[model samples]
Target: MSEIPGLRSAAGEQQGRQIPPASLARLTIYLRALNSLLAEGIERVSSDELAEAAGVNSPMLRKDLSYLGSYGTRGVGYDVQYLNSQISTALGLSQDWRVAIVGAGNLGRALAGYSGFQSRGFEVVALFDADQLIVGTEVGWLRVSPVQDLATVLGRTRANMAVLAVPAGVAQSLCDELVDAGITSILSFAPVVLQIPDHVQLRKVDMATELQILAYHAQRAQDPDLESGPRARAAQ
Candidate 1:
């Protein structure tokens, strides 16, 4: 596989170097901050200001932006539009990615109708369901197809990624089918650990886990003494 073009400076050329995942995540956050700044007609921004906008420290933001080969001009700071373009290209947002949603349930339906995906270069080309009842039904502009037609639909639509929103029990099996169908990237909403091939990129979003985490913080805020309780120590 070829190295990502934007991962290196034009002069530095660190093609063989590995980028830390944390840095990559921060780059996306930086990209979002740039987008908001651009929309507000903000032109040039210093590293400290950008870091404040992104809710991260200035040094870390600089470090993350450095990995994208974009070091702001000394004294003048970064050009907002140019920095945004650099980050976009670095994150592969310069190209449109056709996506497929597996499972025609509630979560799948919501994701399918989300307009934000289209603006960000994610085009949902196909929706699939194992249940025959929803196979021919419409989810937006596209009609739902049978899961059995995954490979054919993927090839026909040229979809490179898929979103798995099915039940935990069927997520792995459906994931296997997606991989077999040549869909390499997947964003899973199933609250379970899915086994995927090393070649395929898989990301999981557990809503329940996030809510539970929030609940824990809320509990701590409500009762400061809870952290000192015997039950908390025993559990820990």
Candidate 2:
């Protein structure tokens, strides 16, 4: 069987510096594109072709890749497998990162059941909630544990990252708890902002806010009478 593609942990240091988030995102996109090419039996690809696959222009792709010190051969193009591995290394996908979800409500349950996280080297080892009734219940082959067991579960599982899916009221306190438990990375789904230690890294997913932004763009498209419309320009 072919070897499974692994990723380097983003928690790693490169040149004693942290990799930028934008670079990390693009690296993942590039990795996916390269993997597709490899699966197609394509060994080499020009920057232009690869960029198109990654949904970016050639120059932009080259600039992004330059951050990793990757330069393709002058005329032969880049080796697909080599570039993919390099990007995986830069994004820290080569190592598995155990994840713990702190909420067992709807969103938490959905996240726990998602298979993509595990496929990408993130294993959801611990699932937690505050309700006594919810605790000890199974959610996708794993039993939901009480939030009170967080510290022990974190230590026993050595979980370095966590997901905060609890209510907005409880998010911050639980976030603090996660930081205290030695979890350095977190993905927060709460509608409100969470305060954590300066050393902790956080990413928030606000579906409502995102949908509002999308709605604005969609409204503008439907009504060219907005600022972007020629009619609006004449009125101004």
Candidate 3:
């Protein structure tokens, strides 16, 4: 387990920092690629091979891995298992993360049923909903708890992380409750922006925004104006 320099928590755990946001995101992709290779019993992988698996260029992948001070040998390539462990440690995947999801809607239920969360160290300990009819319903092993008991349930389940799958209108109130109950990390799917205290870390996943971006790219790809550029003009 190679330790990442200058990346440590107050408790001296391997914490992630200094890496740029884009590089950090790529590290996760690389970790996923490495895990797949490990599953296939691949002992070593060259930069080009790993890059292709991760959908990144060789030079870009090497640059991202450089943040962890991991530069493979010139010809021997990288040890797959070793590199996987290093990235896992750097991303703090070794720690147990218990998640409480607010809103027992379709999305929440789907998220709770995702087995990948457990495989990645996040345990979905609790599910919550504002509706009385939805409460007491089972999503996986978890019985949907009422949102009214949000704070109490969070404390009882010892959930340090939360997912907000509620509507934008009520997202803020639920977010405040989660923060008050000592949840410092939150992943919100609400279409509205949430304001939180400096201590809390909030990550919003706006599906609408992503869809709009995709729409933009799709439109551009089909544009006749783009086809009229140098290559098409030369063909004519």
Candidate 4:
């Protein structure tokens, strides 16, 4: 594993600086692209190629990578193995981060069954839901448990993060309960913004918002005004 400098925790009254969320997210996409390249036995890649594969602009990709210091060559591009190692270290993928999933609905079940979580640093250690009937049911290798067992499961498994896939109506209360149980890091799939303490880290994934964005772009694609700019005459 490569050494990730400045990623260590800080002492009292001194909160450590974190990588920007956008950069962190791009790092994940870069990691995935790098992994694919490695699997294909490709040892070198350019920023333009990587950006295309990762669905990002070349300049933005280069800028995001610059946050971790300059690892790419001026003209040649980046070394695949070295870049992968740097990103892995920076994202804490070199260490194991146990995760617990709250809510055992379709989305939750899908998440539990997904293998990507384990491939990265995240490990799904527990599956939790409030419904009594759903509890004790096996979803893949994990057996569902009641939400009340959150604290116990967290301590027993030493999970530092949680994912909330509950309905929008109950998501906030569930998030509060998770925070109270000492789970600091959260990934919420709910649409509503959750209220958590400063110490807690919350990342929201709003499906509705994403769908709305997609719809906006779809609508724009059908607009004659938007399309006219491509072949329009310029004013002299």
lDDT of 4 by residue, 53-116 (tens): 9988899899888777677777788889878977787776778898899999999999998988
Count steric clashes of candidate 3: 0
TM-score of each: 0.85, 0.84, 0.87, 0.84
Clashes of 1: 0
Clashing pairs in 3: none
Per-residue lDDT value at 38 in model 2: 89
Q: Give the worst 10-residue stretch by lDDT in candidate 4.
A: 7-16
Q: Which residue segments of model 1 deviate by more than 4 Å?
A: 1-12, 226-236
Segments in model 2 whose C-alpha atoms lie over 4 Å from true places: 1-19, 226-236
lDDT for 27 in candidate 4 is 84
Error of 2 at 191 (Å): 0.8
- Full candidate order by lDDT, most accurate first: 3, 1, 4, 2
Q: What overall lDDT goes with each candidate model?
A: 0.85, 0.82, 0.86, 0.84
Clashes per candidate, residues 3 or more apart or on different chains: 0, 7, 0, 0
RMSD of 1: 5.9
Per-residue alpha-carbon lDDT of candidate 2 for residues 98-198, written as tens digits (9 for 90 to 100): 99999999999999999878766789999999999999999997899889999998999888889999889989999999998899999999999888778
Identify the leading candidate in terms of TM-score.
3
The top-ranked prediction according to lDDT is 3
User: How well does model 2 score by local distance difference test?
Assistant: 0.82
Whole-model lDDT, model 1: 0.85
